[model samples]
Target chain A: MPNRQITIAELPTDTLEPRHFQLTETDMPKPGEGEVLLRVILMSIDAANRSWMRGATYRDAVKAGDGMPTYAICEVMESNSPRIAKGDIVAAEATWADYTVTKAHKVQKMPKVEPLSHLMSVYGIAGKTAFHGLMSIGNPLPGETVLVSAAAGSVGGYVGQIAKALGCRVVGIAGGAEKCKWVEDELGFDACVDYREGNLSKKLAAACPNGVDIYFDNVGGKILESALNFMNERGRVVCCGAISQYDTDTPTGPRNLPGVVVVKRLRMEGFIVMDFAHDDAKCVRAMQHWVSTGQIKVFEDIVDGLENAPKALIGLLAGDNKGKRLVRVGADPK
Target chain B: MPNRQITIAELPTDTLEPRHFQLTETDMPKPGEGEVLLRVILMSIDAANRSWMRGATYRDAVKAGDGMPTYAICEVMESNSPRIAKGDIVAAEATWADYTVTKAHKVQKMPKVEPLSHLMSVYGIAGKTAFHGLMSIGNPLPGETVLVSAAAGSVGGYVGQIAKALGCRVVGIAGGAEKCKWVEDELGFDACVDYREGNLSKKLAAACPNGVDIYFDNVGGKILESALNFMNERGRVVCCGAISQYDTDTPTGPRNLPGVVVVKRLRMEGFIVMDFAHDDAKCVRAMQHWVSTGQIKVFEDIVDGLENAPKALIGLLAGDNKGKRLVRVGADPK
Candidate 1:
């Protein structure tokens, strides 16, 4: 099949929108020696992608007129490398297209789990981010209250579950009542606060009376400020992504940041998944065990077609998606 | 010589000034059982004192119509406790008055060293703040570049010296040409930037050819922003104090905080010295060794008279005083 692709036409000019992307068609290129041609099944639209378009991210900025960067689940249709075989499923980072051709080692062969989609959802980017943020940075103590922002979203969902699994009292902040309800009821959070409401502090206070020990922060700005105020002494703010503040040209950061840091003894650190390249297998292995044991729930809000990829990303940034927001590009394997 | 006293007349309401204190006379209280009467020789006027005056600090706030809270080096004039004797010098926290009656348990006996004034400077609060910030929080590598704000001030001066002692390259940021000269010439910093001059970023970049590995931030606002941009990957910002933004009712914090934290993989943590109460002896011992061995320099900008305690504190807050800003309450022991 011919690949349908979306490329960056304009960089985020102070604000990001669907109009910044341009969709185009390209003929499928044959796999070269020591390369694999994969049929992309799903393209993950993540917040970090917005960072790439603006400036240098974990990797180089996705240059203008280039395909949008993404993490994809794919099935190899053709192989020229001895390292990989055709018909093998893999997790790879490639451009946002219906198909991708890359060096064989660029992709990791997907492990066999009950639901193959779980590898792309909970055991994928979101799961790795959550695992690193919660386990490595946060070091949540058992029975300590762990508060997660964007709780119904991909990373936050798994963070709350992992905290709960580690014997923490889990509280979450989501965009709306339905997301909050889904997070609290379905994701096993002790309580979930709807940040859309004005009384976020009051609601959050009510949710975690002991105060927040570990805050898995995905959204920055006001929510971070509120969470900062609600932190326990020596609380950890793991800055996974600042999705809310990314689009602006000049950032108006948290005003109350300094005062709380001294008084609360807070340690706030930011990290990218690429920084843990050596430990990706360890993270994946742990996440796979959690999923296979039914200790974690995986949810995917899959939007169909490469044509809808730009809208999917815009929706994800706007807090419009219910789960791990993805653009499904092809039919599932028989 | 008898004692004189200064008491808080008004709590700081947005702006702090000399009129907030009242000059008064108090009869020197005699030491009761298990107690010591100290002749307050040097009152260390610190930024944390401002925090104490406004509201509760690491300890209770200095109440209006009462002596201000301070850390002081004093001479034990009379002692009822078996552990303390008259004529011994001691370091202690007490209400800021000429004669303070504290339990012998509350005071640490000053170690015998030349220029005993070093006890009130480097072997005191500034020493502890710098040591804890540089050694514990920053954990600066041998060849890493460390940039310090308020480099001529008490804490930043010590931080620069200690970083150099640990084999790290040191750059300092001070307010004026004289202070910059003092920081570079006397403090052994690799370079010093006069922040009063414009093009701070350019000056900083010139100073730090390799990006900053640790930023011992004392002044907040724009200087903090400038330092944030100069950070290397996985750099640590030890949030010791924000003396620049302390006076304001509403804080307008660093703007580039979010982007740099993500891009640089920064870890920013705040710490108060009181948090290391258990390790106080270790800090003092280390500081004493550095001071007695002439490995560290202790500079005190001593302002005379108990009548001027309020002025001394106000000057320290306004960045008027150099080195450890302290008010001499009594004559040095002969």
Candidate 2:
């Protein structure tokens, strides 16, 4: 019966378990009026899934018997909704479940591309968030410099690529030489500094000689502090995520932010991609164009089976994923 | 013959020297090719004049044998430049000297006004700074809420009054009940909160129920912190001066500043009025109009004699000045 739907009955801290989800055998979720039944194909594993449990914005996660928080690409097997017909491939937000019944409008039609897999990578929510952070908040102009942290990660890779496409000199901060090289050579970033080399501040300063015009901060902590010293006057800092402090009991305080904002007259803003979902069509169109033009690239670190989802999430938190971490829940569509 | 102007080597920090300036006759100074000799009639005493001695902005205040950085109503007694002639009354930056020779353009022809003294008060640098901070950076649109700290002081008074004239609901934060009443009743501010009331945050929140849209921050300590919690989304904080932090060895950091920027997406920019000296005429005309129409009021806490300059400056630091603190060097010319 649809491989027995699994759901989280209780929250977990520091570790996750299969008990977080209850496997129940039942009739595959039927598409009610104005709804479509979606079969989960691919689901992304993120470090922020833990934080989603406590955040006010993710109150839906706290609802009893709700599935895990996940973004997945699915195939509409049945539809009573006018917007979607049978066999329509789509992307939707659902939990750790084999099948989900959702509103038709919530399912975005997957775009066609060379690597059909990229529909869930750079053209997906992670990639779109990075794009928006650079374009909307960072507002990088041609000839200006853009610095991105966690450069080898999916979001960081997209940030660097998008900034490069906009004619900005892009610098990336990552953990290792391999990741740094991949970000520079593969992702097309101008330069990548390895934060693992130590002396992060010194290296960052040397890399950004003209000073950073835009900083798309993903791994905020000491890296954000180091980047602040290199920001030029009237710089824009986009705070997309703070992965470095996500698991800590007490969030790290940025000591130098006050002086940075005052002396440089900088603008720093935080945003969530869900807030931009109202214009999903516009985002999808822009991302699709960039993907087709080869101006953007996507990397997927895929793991087989839903049983590996927790492990993939743990690996993501440990910085093991070179790009977007996805757990294949079912067979790929022909 | 005139005094080449000598004064106490340096005024004591704690007390005023009764014999601050001695107008002993030395020799009549000759005007150079681009210089004019001026007979001082009136001079302004500003809070910054105190820090001028320690080389704050105006490099090392007129050494023992030099003139002070005082703006005065003067008569051009002698000139070697074609731009100015003898017996022309002008406004010049002549220090505590009885008569001095300076560059011709440094002496601006005194504008005709009913109370000629008002020109030196309202059309002065402090007024211009207040205007620039309020209109340029603050940009207080009509029906917006504006809050000014140290609202009874020189710059703060203008900030409140100008905000009111711009159709903003203005709130003032001052130390005492008297000053608070003065800012609200006399300056036409919508509300005033006495910070000395112990619960400044509560009082401010109660007064500015709509939330502060623009904040003209003159005192930048606890008041700035309190205002941060009350800022509306997209609030603009004009940092004209941080008087509260100027003297302290270690300035207390505004605890709520980072959250203020993130939550409200606030813009806080620091500025110096000297940056707008090229467009001083526009500000002068605007201020004169506001004064002539009775839409603006000038508050001058006249401390008589140049000798009381030290006390007046100290009073300024202690938030003792009710409005613009001026040293009446000579009789006010009607």
Candidate that scores best on DockQ:
1
For model 2, residues B25-82, the per-residue Cα lDDT tens digits are 5677778889998876666766555445433232455444444677777778789889
Tens digit per residue, CA lDDT, model 1, B1-334: 5556778888877778888888777677888889999988888888777877666645677788878878888889899988988999898887778889999998988875555667767877788899988888999889999999999998999999888877899999998899899888888889999988899999999999998999998977888988998898899999998887676677777777666786778999999887877787898888767767776888889988888888887878877777988888888887
TM-score, candidate 1, is: 0.96
Candidate whose TM-score is highest:
1
Clashes of each: 0, 2
Global Cα lDDT for candidate 2 = 0.75
Between which residue pairs do clashes occur in model 1?
Answer: none
Clashes of 1: 0
Local accuracy by lDDT, each model: 0.84, 0.75
lDDT tens readout by residue for model 1, A244-292: 8787776777887676787778898988877776788898888768777
Docking tier of model 2: it is incorrect
